[model samples]
Target chain A: MRYVTPRKAAVGLGASHTGTEHHWWMTVSSAALALLTPSFLMVMGTALQLPERADILLYFTRPYPAIVVAIFMTLGMMHFIKGSRIMIDDYLEHTARKVAIIGFSIFGWAVIAFTLFALARIQLAFAQAI
Target chain B: MADVNRGNRPLSPHLQVYQLPLAAITSIVNRAAGQAMVAGLLLLAFWLLGAAAGGGLWDWADWLTRSWFGFLVLLGSCWALWYHFLAGIRHFFYDAGEGLEIETARMTSIAIIAGSVILTLLSLIIYWI
Candidate 1:
């Protein structure tokens, strides 16, 4: 058996081809999150401190906060779903892996859907007020 | 023919046989932190749903998140998020064939721990002030 070099693995020049793709996916997504997480945290951390519900809604009503939350949620959960699948593959066998993958996929998508919907509603409230 | 009935299990020695290195520790903790984030994300979904279907749900979620216990949980999750995030950045360098040397791995591991703590505390300061 031959060991694949990391360089070849990264560029898809390796004997086993799929590793490169997964590596790239995780790399790119993680890089995106590294940038987005701080901005997202600033927006969310402020919202977390807001005392009034109406104030919270008004805060998210702004375009930058709403857009950052939406993008961050989408990307973060997408990364989660993929990362979970990799873990499941490593530790699970047969039916267990299948069930876990499905469960995580649903959970990730559900979070994305609910978050985007809520952000949209908050923005709509602001629109009505103006 | 060789003895077919002989039980021969060729097993690779695992954690029990080897000392856990900093890199291994970081990798394991990263997986754990990812799982923690999933749980945190579930809580977030409930909060968002409360916001979307506001009567008193949003207020209730807000109340819980503002409570002392909720604050503690949020702080822990915040640490998890940051640790996982920094560890992830280290992994990117790994994938690019940059940080596999022993010293770099140790340095990055320490950075992940220190960076996460600093970032979490900074966020808290920003929140309070």
Candidate 2:
């Protein structure tokens, strides 16, 4: 009753060689993002409305807002990395596709790193001042 | 057993020849919106980094984001976010084996498009108020 052929079973993954991992992760991240998007939007909306630089910084200094942003940015970028790779795979081929995937993966990670670093700095500065 | 005629064979109707259905259009737009959100995220990262760095960097980023050009970009980003978000929900329903009927799918596709616009406008109005 096994649907898979002997070769497919031996190879484990399907023709693409990626199996279902990409789709699985994309589903998980998309579900998490479904919740995170609204909360993050509210946080960003409130932060942007503040007129003063210090006030904006102070707003993110609070643990709740900071945590929301940190999680959102990290998860969102990870989702983007996976999602964009699929899009690139569909439209590009060979060398160009390889380069685009690598470029986007690096960009996504850098954004995550920069976002966490900024959030940390905001928290540290607020701590030192008070 | 190479019988030839591979290159000469007529192919199925492709993107150019076929008019895509509503569901197909919505699905493709969802992908496009996801990419747009990436650009929006980069703008957000710049804003955050500038705030953390402070001084001239913050001033420059703040001014840039507050400018008319930036406003347009943010507005588009807002719409993209809503469109993608609603499309994600539709996808979830599809995954769960719901709303897969042709009529239902078309209705939901239209709802996504209209709902996203309404939500985007509502968010902006709330922000302005």
Could you estimate the TM-score for every candidate? 0.85, 0.89
lDDT of 1 by residue, A1-130 (tens): 6597777557844654564676678778888888998898788787776676788788888889888889988989999999988889899999998999999899899889989989888888778889
- Lowest-scoring 10 consecutive residues by lDDT in candidate 2 chain A? A8-17
Tens digits of lDDT, candidate 1, B1-129: 976875678667686887788988998999999888666566666676677668888778766766786778778888899999888888777877998999889888989989999989988898889
Which candidate's DockQ is highest?
A: 2
Give lDDT for model 2: 0.90
* Docking quality tier of model 1: medium
Instruction: Give the winner by lDDT.
Output: 2
Which window of ten consecutive residues has the lowest lDDT sum in model 1 chain B? B37-46
Clashing pairs in model 2, backbone N/Cα/C closer than 3 A: none
lDDT per residue (tens digit) for residues B5-87 in model 2 = 67867778887999888999999999999999777778888889999999999999888877887778888998999999999
Give interface RMSD, per candidate: 1.4, 0.8
